[model samples]
Target: MLSPRAIAHKILLHIEQESGYPDRLLQSYLDRYDNLDPRDKGLITELVFGVLRWQGRLDSIISRFSSVKLKKINPVVRIILRTAIYQILFLDKIPARAAVNEAVKLARESQPDYVVRFVNAVLRRVSDNIESLKKVDKTNLTASGIAEIYSHPKWIVDAWVKELGTEETAELCRANNKTPPTSIRVNTLLTTSENLAEELRRAGIEVQPCKYAPDALEVKKGHFNLQRLEAYEKGLFQIQDEASQLVAHILTPRPEERILDACAGFGGKTSIFAQLMENSGEIMAVDLSPWKVATLEENLERLKIGIVGTLQTDVRKLNEMNIKPFDRIFLDAPCSGLGVLRRKPDIKWKRRPGDVYRLSLLQRDLLDSLASLLRVGGVLVYATCTLLNIENSEVIESFLQNHPEFCIEPISDTIPWMKVFARGPYFCSFPHRHGTDGFFAARLKRIK
Candidate 1:
């Protein structure tokens, strides 16, 4: 019978110190408390994600009122303050008195009397000056200022500003803070997008066709878990971003062709490729993690796809496996995952400035190793759910320079909405502009 705040505190503490994903941890808690009402569930979700999303700003405000530095504060006490301060600053339905009272109560339960007093004093001050704290003067926006105002790390804000310009970077940050739409791709093998949309509407789920991907449906309203839906169980659709759905189309895998999903993590794109090929092609799906390969195998079974063969092996060691060259190859290389921050807010805090450079080198090595596995004239679609130049364009440029046999290919004919996300010969989607995750994909063909 834990309160929503209590549940959020436990999840936050674990997220701060442990290795569990917030979404998975939250879902496990929700499932454990099956009798808990939707209101409590919603509150727990909001508190956990909101506190994490705005942790930087909350810490800044907390430091302003407390004599103690943030790092010096006990972790439990820190999360309690963060959760309370988040409600006061952001959640309008929550009264200031309730936020402060709950925080003090939680603090009293876990901390000493002095810590409770300190928590009460800081929160009361924050509550009294909440209006002033809400206002940020956007007229003079520096990179550091944007970071503080938007609750993103300064390095991320600075990098975005340098790459996307100040105005667009701010817009991107704003988009990242928004709760992204739950978009799913209709599994065209079993049902058409039109039919799936009709079925979802009949099931009382509000959905609409996405503009970017032909098969994507943007779910507007639904309380039911999508996995439990009749359509989902029947393999009518799979939860995927509109931008991600486009990568498989960009590769344009033909029926009966041999394809390789070199870094297939959970098989989102592999599943789509199976459907696009009408489950007729041979798709060798490889991943470094056995757990992910197992999950991909489960997905392939649920989707009733038979063309994909699962392999649990490192993508960089594909040549060692003695696999044959394929007509199509998909290298959805791992990067910083900056592009999907809206869905995974914790990434904004977990990633360091140097991690981007390190990930970029890994991406380059992946491309270099996997490129040789593509047959001459075969299409290799290199994709990442990241927008950074070092990870996207720079990696591709270096690869093309080192291997002159591959050339960038235009993707306009791959799908009808290519014009929506096409950047010359490459596919790029921004969260702010595309209403989807920031993604970069390049279609390269071997010319030798």
Candidate 2:
């Protein structure tokens, strides 16, 4: 029987060497490996995500004791320490001695003599200070909250500090570190939200209705193998957040009206738009990524949605389609994904704050590019899955100033959950406040 640590080491090594998402990799691992029981599967998940969440602090501990350079350590040894220390600190069930012993075994096999010795010394030292590491010192800036609780970039915290104030930013950081609730949108065309909830319940899954998104349901967390379920294969539901579902709703597509989902990579929102339009209106789903466009087509096929026309072309080069002015266009621009830190914890570590401004410029350009295709009096919903002011409201504000023909139409009480979030009639959702992924949207009408 392969120990859970061995499996975790392999997964972590893949994460470090290859460019793949931890979520997808973990899922694939669980699906492909047959020897794992539910308990072992749970252990592997805890070890992998725990190490990833506390990478910064784990490195600090290694640097404090190890004589060798941090960069020179073998990747295998590093992953061993990551798995061991992760158990020692976060997982209450894993006894400290077992973690150390297994780590030493891994180190000796994969690393040289010098590295193995150093890793042994480091893991022992970390075990001694494990209690101290777990202690919460609210006064210290590098305390557990910012270090372990948020699992976010220090620069992101600093940026949030400037924007959301110290206390509010701390709340935001805490919210991001938590395991996000699994919210899925019911395909209203196939079923109602209440019926879907009942179906999930009958299938031994607990689900609750989302307070915000009318068509969304919050599933019980730590679900195992949702893809294997007949419900998933039949496409009774889609995995999307409440806030994201709201974006398509905000677009408010009427039946028979032509729509363009510009920059619709993989078409999550586009599928929702098709459902809302009752499969009557035409939707041109365009993206720069040809691979993603192909994936989008497959997803549409899986959902049994036939109304969307998937096109693999950059909307920036608008000449690809000899298209007439559309009644509505949904611009779900790409941003730094700051608001979705809970779903993709690695994004916080990977992104620099400066990248937001660069993306803001691109978002503005994309808006202008797509706006040219909208007819006068047509509605255009500009949206982003980001919380940064630079990417959200600021980009829209800049676009409004540059384009005199477009006006920010006041969106008063379109969605009931949005009643409290009236930031000058612009819709913004935050994890801390709205219990949804961070999102921003504004309604604009082209005036003659």
Cα lDDT of model 2 overall?
0.81
Model-by-model lDDT, in order? 0.89, 0.81
TM-score of 1: 0.97
> Tens digit of lDDT per residue, candidate 1, span 1-448?
7888999999999999984778878888888886898889889989988988899999999999998998999999999999999999999999999999999999998789999999999999999999999888987688888888888999999888998899888888888888888899888888887888889889989998887687788999885367778888888889998888887788888899999998899999999888878889799999998989999999989999999888888888878877789999999998999999887888889999899999999999999998889999999989999888999999999999999999988666555568778776678899999889999999899999
Clashing pairs in 1: none
Model 1 misplaced regions, further than 4 Å: 412-416
lDDT of 2 by residue, 198-286 (tens): 87887888998888787888888435777666777777888888888887788889888899999998789999988988888799999
Local error of candidate 1 at residue 1 (angstroms): 0.7
Please tell me which predicted candidate would have the highest lDDT against the true structure.
Answer: 1
